[model samples]
Target chain A: MSQLANVLNITKAPQPSCQAQRLTASKSLSARQQQELRAILEQGLPQVAQPYLAIAEQINASPDQVLAQIALWQEQGLIKRFGLVVKHRQLGFKANAMVVWDIADEQVDAVAKLLSSCPEVSLCYRRPRRLPDWRYNLFCMIHGTDRAIVEAQIAAIVDKFALQAVNKDILFSVKAYKQQGARYTKKGNCHG
Target chain B: MDKQSRQATTPVAELTALDKRIINLLQRGLPVVERPFLEIAQQLGCHEDEVLERLNHLMTNKVLTRFGPMFDAVCLGGAFTLAALAVPEPEFERVTEQVNSFDEVAHNYRRSHDFNMWFVVGAESAEQVNNVINDIESKTGLPVLNTPKLEEFYVQLYLPA
Candidate 1:
């Protein structure tokens, strides 16, 4: 195992209760089966007539077992959402900006709620600011087909929220070095 | 090539009205059933074959990068954080290479700012996340601004095709 793996395994030692709680709350399948199912799903669900069946065949399990495990995991909130991960860049969204706002502590939640409701805003979250360097607390992303459109949207947002006095920064992506799925299983697991 | 050149060279594929509708519907999610495509076809007033064909085409053309279940890493005993490093212009490429070499570095992007190099580090625990950040700082001789998510208000991206 890699050093990272060793760290992970050591961390996993203290979380047995959490794992047990999850298992009991959603005990439709064994832990091993759940792990196998996640390993298969991390790659992606097959785009076929019987995707679950295909998954079962690959995992050497029954179709019913695979479907049941998926349903159980969804119920337990282990899976956020099973859907199409669209590549916005390929879909004509050439401009993607991570906009950060330095809002008052009392108004942060209200601002986040307003930002999340906007159609153009894809991701909205409140992150801790690093003082003496970074002071932005609320972060959201706006994607558009061009920089002009994105700027217009930002202007509209500022006008709507009366955030003219609030400090803000827009960081546009100039290049992407790596983009891929998050690895959850062990180093030599099914994910290659 | 720069951003301007890359955008100019991007292939423009003509999407029909039906294709647009399908893309919109599938983005929300697909039902977990034996014949999900059939279900989608029924909703969109189209044939299963047509739905499958358009999806296949989209994937083939790289319009839809992936289609699957997005698991919550934290729930599965993992951790992740967004970090940024401000490398001098002369050492940008070298710093990027050093940052991206780690297997834990999931996505790295060059943004328009002094803290130009922004990337996400995913590990098995919060300590591991800190370790990766520390390792990167020591390796690159630069301080990394670590900003892990304290609270997530909303996290979903739905683009109308």
Candidate 2:
């Protein structure tokens, strides 16, 4: 089939039937196979007609098995997201700020939920506060085209949420010496 | 291994209309199927090769660093932490090299704060993560403020390119 017809068929096509074999796939992936799959996927998908089939070939599995296994991972929350990882900095979102706020323990969860929903706040995580040095427990990253843009988004969030009473600080990034994917802890001993 | 190589990126390279649409659309994620790119092209009203060509161009120019499964460390039994070091200005470069030399250090950046340097250390397990942190402290001769994430409230970040 021509490329156009192949894709056009997908629009009206029913979703892949991988989920039909969900129960079997759940037990099929061994720890070693899981690790191997992770390693393989970290290499990124090939831009091909059958990316999953390509991956399955490497691990001695059928295409349907690969699709089913990946679907299982997504359901189990093992795969956080399965898509494009765009470089925001090159897209003009240079102003990156790690905004940390010391919201009270009782209220931190509520504040974090609200802060995270904002389109501007890209990453929001709650970390333990190191008292006397770092009192901030809530961290949110806002990347913008410049400082002003970032600051405005933050300010709007603060005003909208009434975070004035909360002690906060915005640590702007100066220089990135190294920025790469968090591949895993020690590829040498991932089997453990 | 398509390890997003460490290097300087071209500054805000020009993007065509389709390029932006692809970035925004893919942010939602590709369906797990045979010809995921083809599905994406259909959504954007373009040919599969055109979409593939644009993606290649974007990645080649370092616009899209990755285009695949983003696994969760905790779920995968992997360890990850965001640590900081308050390196004196004069020794910043030396300390950066020391901290970044470790394979565990995923990314290091100079943040404007008392603790000027911050980097994430990833390991296969919690014990290994601690070991990497200890190594960084001794090598740099600076106290490492360890701050592992306690809870991830939200993560998907979409920017209209």
Per-residue lDDT of B42-149 in model 2, one digit per residue for the tens? 888899999888988988888887788866656556778899998999998799889888988866888999999988888877899999999988898888999998
Give the runs in model 2 whose Cα sits over 4 Å from its true position: A1-36, A180-192, B1-9
DockQ result, candidate 2 = 0.44
TM-score for each prediction? 0.84, 0.82
In CAPRI terms, model 2 is classed as: acceptable
Q: Per-residue CA lDDT of candidate 1, range B127-154, in tens?
A: 9889989999999999999988766654
Considering the true interface contacts (CA pairs under 8 Å between chains A and B), give the fraction that model 1 also has.
Answer: 0.59
What lDDT does model 2 reach? 0.76
* TM-scores of chain A, one for each prediction: 0.74, 0.75
C-alpha RMSD values across all candidates: 8.7, 8.8
The two-chain DockQ for each candidate, comma-separated, is 0.46, 0.44
